[model samples]
Target chain A: MKIAIVGAGALGLYYGAMLQRAGNDVRFLLRRDYQAIRKDGLSVTSPNGDFHLQAVQCALDPAELGPVDLVLVGLKTFANHRLIELVAPLMQDDTCVLTLQNGLGNEELLAKTFGAERVLGGIAFLCSNRGEPGTVHHMGQGRIRLGELSGGFSERATALARMFNQAQVPCEAVDDLRRARWEKLVWNIPFNGLSALTGKNVTELLRHEPSRREIIAIMGEVIAAGNAQDLNTPIEAEIFIEKMISATETMDGYRPSMMIDRLEGHPLELEAIYGVPLTRATACGVEMVRVRMLHALLELGERN
Target chain B: MKIAIVGAGALGLYYGAMLQRAGNDVRFLLRRDYQAIRKDGLSVTSPNGDFHLQAVQCALDPAELGPVDLVLVGLKTFANHRLIELVAPLMQDDTCVLTLQNGLGNEELLAKTFGAERVLGGIAFLCSNRGEPGTVHHMGQGRIRLGELSGGFSERATALARMFNQAQVPCEAVDDLRRARWEKLVWNIPFNGLSALTGKNVTELLRHEPSRREIIAIMGEVIAAGNAQDLNTPIEAEIFIEKMISATETMDGYRPSMMIDRLEGHPLELEAIYGVPLTRATACGVEMVRVRMLHALLELGERN
Candidate 1:
């Protein structure tokens, strides 16, 4: 299978490297450093250890890549819109585009750009970041959950999972991907926005009574909003907050991606993580003032 | 008239010097740095001009001062409770202690500590900070509105106003001091908290629509809580937000005192500004989840 990794940041590199080691032809579509990587090598340092793979094909322009079986989209939510447009050259009639980006409404955005059948829901559960141009550093566990947007498990989805599993990456196929996405969204919108705004880490945010109360309140809002939209994913606000708190306690100093964006003065995913959900909730006539306020602050932070 | 300036940081020094220039014997109960000024002199830079008063008496202990006609308590809200005990020696049977601290509940706390008759409700319009131990810098208007906690224009309150006017610090005696205090409380609680939590200047906070809206929401919550307590100071949320936006338009890069405290790692007025108001709202059965959340994050930030 010929696979091209779009927006080849850490997740894309991880997928591309694993797929390549599993006897699939993998190419990385990246920034200017893509060509340099093709000339030098692709590097990955993980918990399993470090290694360099020199045979990985890399390209800055999607036109330079050959016809591919799968194209994994790994751009930030802010970049996913335009990136889907730019990576159109690599998508054939059967070429599947799987989005592993965080936030809500990303899949819909991709489905609008590409056909619904070609867009799959992918969730990467790992702590990784870009080290340098072609190098990716894994901060913790590396596992991915992939499923078709159309609901049923297709042969292609399982084939992709099997290939990923063969390459020393954990991959699982879930019956309903939307539920997983919303469950993650429930955590991301509140925790990310609160932490980024306050500049506090997880334990500090969740351990304090007021902070914990807010997390539960915000999660309740998100869960209610999701259920209101008729999504069957049920989340007890306390349970969700505790899970996030546990995850954060394990990674104490780990700044969420939003915090990193705040420090680097980069545009944040305010629209996807904060804005869209609240907008939907308001349109649905749900009182979501807290999340709405945080969203507005984040939008201002991003704009300024 | 003899006057003692308790906790003589910025406002204390400003009022003390003005009183001294009015031919009153003024003494400062100061910290170690100002204690050194007991041997030196007091210098102040104000909007009108800069001057040094050589005869200004300074004391390291409040007990060292003689019975004063008036005592101006000008410490930050964080130190108000503890500092109340120290200022007792400076007061005689007829002496009044006027509190000009920021945030809500300080006057009430003062009344609880030193009898309501002695505690005046004071709202200062000046922006002054300690330039050094013995030097205070005044910016903008150095005016105050003060009256007895009973909300009457008593002879004592009238005398204090006359003295303040003679001392060159503009002063007013309001018929309803509680309303005035609550009005200022409405402004102080939300803006100060927002600025401190976001590390944003007043203009930056108000100019941004999201922050602007969140601020208005928090202020509305405070006003609701105040009204529930029978303080009939009415404020339209939208109108108040616009007023704040316009007021902050001219003042750029000005950090709120709370923000300064947080940055300098000083003990914050979290209880005075946030905890008290939140507690009030809770008692009134008015929801203030957002304000409580911000306070919780601040508590965490304080710990950090």
Candidate 2:
């Protein structure tokens, strides 16, 4: 399969290097670093190991690229729609697009832009940050699971999963990606908002009792909302919260991306991560007082 | 009557200078600049004008100053109980002490130390910060109202008011100072926490709609807690929230003291401004989810 990786950040770089190594024609679509990566190749350093690869096509213009079988979207959620518009010309009739962005609603966006049949849902569980333009530091787990939004075990989805699994990137093809997305949403909504608001690392925030309780309350609200929407994500508030607390206990001090945005004075994922889930739940008439408070704090903190 | 001014910050300095100019014997219990003030005199600068007097007595040693008639305490709330044992020597059998500290529960701490009869609740309605050791910057309205916590209209309280009035420092005697303290508590509990949590100035915070709404909600909780205590505060939740919103509109660009403490990494009045009120309200069975949230966020910010 000829795969074109669009919106190259840490996740894009990680998959680009892996899929290229697995004997597929993988190209990176980026504007700024095309010349540099074309000259020097891509570098991915992970705790699993380090891989330096050459023979990867890098281009600045999406239209210049030939028709590709799969195009992986790995931009920030805020940039997803614009990038989709930019890369629409590169997709042929059979070309499929996959979005592995954080937070909710990106899949719906991709489905709206492209046909629902061509868009795939993904939950990429990786602790990665940009080491440089061509280098990605996969600090921890780098596993991804892909599924069709319409709950079909299609041949295309299985082939994509087999490709990823053969590349040693653990990939699971699930019947329902909505459950996967909401499960990940439960984790991101609390930890991301807590770390962003308190300016603390994951471990420190979980240790603070009130912060811990508030995050748990927020998760409860999220779970209730998810249940109301009939997603039935299968995790209770206490169980999910305890899972996060236990996970953060071993983390070697990681600041959430939202915190990084706030410290750097960049626009945060305010309306998306903390806002959308609650607003959706409110449509179902679920009370999201805790989530609303977090939204209010984020709004206040972002004021100049 | 002789008076000893505890806490040589801006308000204490202003009060000491005014009392001395009123022909009452006044001595300042201060820190490093005692000798400097004793030699070069004390200076009070205001919009009205600047004035300096050489006859003001300043002492670093509490033993050096004999029995005094009144003690004016105007330190920050964090510094309240810290030097309690050190400042005991300046008080005589009949000496009355007044506390003009910000936030709630200051009077309880003072009463615990100096007995309720000797403790008077004080509120300084002036805009001031530390200009220098011997010099104070007094701006805008300059008035202080203080009275017994027990509703006793004592002669000593009357005498202190007269002395203050004679010194051109507008002074009034209230029947109950606890209510006045709660009124001030409403301001500090919400504004101070919001300022510290967001690290923004008053105008920047209150100008935004979401922030302003959350702030009013938090203040409503504070007012509810106050009314639950039956403290005679009389500030309804709606009126109290409206007043707080109006304050941001009227006062142009002010950063609350909690912001100052966070910027300097000083010990915040987290326990007093947030935790104490919440604890009190919870004990009285008042619902204060916002207060509890503020307390959590402030504590988390403090730890970070």
DockQ for model 2 equals 0.66
The reply for model 1, stretches above 4 Å from the true place, is A32-36, A150-155, A236-239, B32-40, B150-153, B232-245, B250-253
Q: Give every collision pair in model 1.
A: none
Model 2: per-residue Cα lDDT over A169-274, one tens digit each: 8998877777777777777887788778888888887788888887777777777777777653465767776886687678778887788778878778776676
**Residues A1-304, model 1: lDDT tens digits:** 7888887767788777767866888888878567668677888898888878888787767888956888888887788558766668888888888888887677788788787888788788877888877788877877888888877678878987888889888988876777677677777877788888878766677777777778778888887777666554555666776776677677766677888778778778877777677777777778776788778667766655
**Lowest summed-lDDT stretch of 10 residues in model 1 chain B?**
B229-238
Query: Cα deviation in Å at residue B133, candidate 2?
Result: 3.2
Q: Give me the TM-scores for chain A across all models, comma-separated.
A: 0.92, 0.93
Superpose all Cα atoms of candidate 2 onto the true structure and report the RMSD in Å to 1 decimal.
2.5
Binned by DockQ into CAPRI classes (incorrect, acceptable, medium, high), candidate 2 is medium
Please, what are the lDDT tens digits per residue for candidate 1 over residues B66-130? 68887788887778657667777877888878888776677787778679877886888777777
Per-residue lDDT of candidate 2, residues B1-304 (tens digit): 8888877777788878877887888878888568778788888788878889887777777777757877778767777666475457878888777877776677788778788887887788776666666678777567888888787577767877887899998988887676666677778877788788888878887777777777777777777788887764476777667766786677678877788779889878887677777778889999788778778888888664
